[model samples]
Target: MVGVETSQHVQLSYEPAGVGDRVLAYLLDGFFMGVYFFVVFWIWGYWYSLGSDPADLSLSWVFYVVIVLPLMLYHLVSEVLWKGYSPGKKIVGIRVVKVDGSRADLSGYLIRWLFRLVEISMTSGVIAFVAVIMNGKGQRLGDMVGKTCVIKERKKAKLEDTLFKDVSEGYEPVFPQVTELNDKDIRVIQDVLDARSHYEYDTWFKMLKRTRQKLEARLGVQDHGMRTDVFLETIIKDYNAIHGSVK
Candidate 1:
């Protein structure tokens, strides 16, 4: 496990898979590619065996193109649309992201796919597999070209189980309100929390003021004097409280 302190509030932890998830993804992709390649090869061979001129043998490239197209397209679409995890990757709970902690884009995806040829050149992609295991960021040559890293999503810790392990239970906040907040506001708060280390006290103060203003505008509340940290904490506490009760 490699711990990257992305920010004071967001400690990004990399859960390294010991040759398990990678092997699984490789097996799944290999299975898909093998099936696809076999079908295309069979069709192409059949078409050629039907007395089609050997001079036109280059048409077999079409099958290769067809097979390659889906692989490229799937990666591009999944990275851009779903922020990384293709069906196989999602099933295995691994996702790719840029080194700077952003989602991969079209250029990055293309670079990744193009460089994958180098990674998989030798039999079984053992070189790439070794690179992933040895690299600090769990990145292969393709991932280096794409400036991406694979990471597993952190499992959500059960609050009740941890919180009550030491204390005798019945802890509650002083006030709870089921106030509505907009998605943009929520994203802003999350971003702020994620940027804690990059921001100074004055910068945080300014952001808090802006957040409060945005909250006031969105929620139509004229007076919300709670400090930004307190406000966020309260909202999360109330949400957990209500959510726990409902569950």
Candidate 2:
């Protein structure tokens, strides 16, 4: 397990995916690619099947643009669109992340994708397997160069561990409706809140909006132009005030 300190200084632990799991994910991704190839071949003609030297100009150009280019960019496109999860990685419950539990930038993703040609395609994954096993952090050559690692998506900390704190003296509660949230709900809110700084702006905004909508529906309260992050922060403080540790 790797320990990461969030921007808030909260300690979070993530288990690195094993080499075996990564290999399985790779194979699964290959299977997805094979499916894609079969579909493209079926839709277009089997021009590249076995010694077919036909000269159909438009068909050939269409195939090259539709099939070849996308095939070449598949891994890169998938990771970016899904935020570090290829379809296979999403199914396997693992994802790419920076060492410090932050979202990796586009350059990092590109580096990893570029290295895939040598690490997996050229070497048949031998180099990647060895590197991932030798390093305890589940990093292949791509991950090392990209400064990222694959980690299991399971969160380690339980709600009981940090659900309540000592409410400061002279604190006024903003929303009595916060008590409508149970401990589990509080934990989910806290998790999203703590994780906000780790994501880039767009992702964080979407997440905040979703969480805020859900809370507003349940609590019968609207933000009324209040910032959503502040709404959640105030919820946590109000919860602490209601059911906090003894002073």
Candidate 3:
């Protein structure tokens, strides 16, 4: 799990996905691959048992190469272009990211795939599955080696309700003098207000406190006795009202 604390009214947090999800994903991938391999093996067996000349066995390697290359190409192309997610993973709503909270790059993807050989070679991936099950962060051998973790996609929050609630009820702004907020501060505020209803009360309160501190420091405004939540509600309402009128 990684905790991100913003110095504004935004509480963004995420947990690494558990082993059950990973196992299900693996089984899905395996099912697809199994069907593919069955067709390939059937063709190979038919070709080899034809009682052809021994020299024709040299051409059997060609069939093996043909069978393996497409699977490899599929992995290579999808991971590089889609940021560590294949079509299946995308459908499952899981994505891989680096430990530093960035998208997984080409190198990370390659490393993870390479390490997957070790995972596959150990008791038909039983060892790797167990490792993910036991690990605190739900990391398999490949994930540990690649320094990546799977995370669920977050739902986008609705901003209109949180930002304009009290304003629609005729609430007045208390901090009238604070101005010239930066883009980052504004974004943090937008995120916080948007997701206000999704988070716990304590989390919301902490975000409000941080936003108040940052706003006061940046604008050099003296703090009024108003509650942080009330101040935020008032400011967002004022902004929306002013901006809405201009449009």
Candidate 4:
């Protein structure tokens, strides 16, 4: 388990996939891509053989443009559309995300895709393996440039970790303003809540207070006559109830 510290100073745990896993995924991706190109090339070859002059085969520009271009673009397109999982990464149960625990944006994804030519393709992955080993974060050159790391996908232990709560009937959300917070904000709130009982009183209070202040600022609410812990819990319950209904 590696700790990825976010910009907000919250540390999240994720298991970084090993070099072996990455290599296996790469081989799988290569096999699939190879099969695709082989079929396309075979079709084109047969068509040209039947009618076109044999001399035309020397140009072969069509194959490069049609097959190679899309192959090179594959990583860029896949990561962008699938939110950081190429077909290989998806198969291996790994995904790329920003170090801050937020989603990787388009430019970040593009940077990783571009660096793949040097780190993986051009070097046959020697450079990638060395970098991943040294970085301790499962980062290839692409990941470094993109500010992202690949993490293994696994089932979380606690229900609260995923932020699903059971709100009772007749629940009136004290603050509809809770909607102003996004998933990352709520995740940090939940993390604080879940960790509070484990820490000393003063330590817990400090974290709780910070969380409360942040939420209060975002929601523009204050001094609701509820205990600090209760206020935070209520906000979470209210958010789940409101968002659940919308879903």
User: How do the residues 1-247 of candidate 4 rate in per-residue lDDT, one tens digit apiece?
Assistant: 4455554565446678888888888888888889889998898789887898767665668657779888999888988899978899899888788865567899889898889999988999899999999998889888888898887876456654457677777888879998887767766777777765456778778777777876787788977888888888888888887877321
Over all chains combined, what TM-score does candidate 3 have?
Answer: 0.70
Residue-level lDDT tens digits of model 3 in 35-108: 88898778767877887565765676665677766665655577678886766666666777776446877777
Rank list by lDDT: 4, 2, 3, 1
lDDT of 2 by residue, 1-247 (tens): 5657544334445778998778888888999988999898765565545545556535667777888888888889998889888988988888888876567678888998999999988999898889999989988888888898889887556544557656778787888888788877776667777765566777667677778888889889974567988887778778988877444
User: Positional deviation of 175 in candidate 1, in angstroms?
Assistant: 3.7
Candidate 1 local lDDT, 63-178, one digit each (tens):
45777676556555665677777666777777777765556677777787676666764546887888887885768888887777777765655644322122224757433443
Whole-model alpha-carbon lDDT for candidate 4: 0.79
* Candidate 4, residue 143: lDDT: 89
Q: Which run of 10 residues does model 2 get worst, by summed lDDT?
A: 5-14
TM-score of 2: 0.62
Backbone clash total for model 4 is 0
* Residue 145 alpha-carbon offset, candidate 3, angstroms: 2.7
Predictions in order: lDDT:
0.61, 0.79, 0.65, 0.79
Q: Best-fitting candidate, measured by TM-score?
A: 3
Q: What is the TM-score of each candidate against the true structure?
A: 0.56, 0.62, 0.70, 0.66
Clashing pairs in 2: none
Could you tally the backbone clashes for each prediction? 0, 0, 0, 0
Off by over 4 Å in 3: 4-11, 34-65, 73-76, 157-187, 190-207, 245-247
Model 4 ranges with Cα > 4 A deviation? 1-15, 105-107, 153-164, 167-188, 191-206, 215-231, 234-247
Query: What's the lDDT of the predicted structure labeled candidate 2?
Result: 0.79
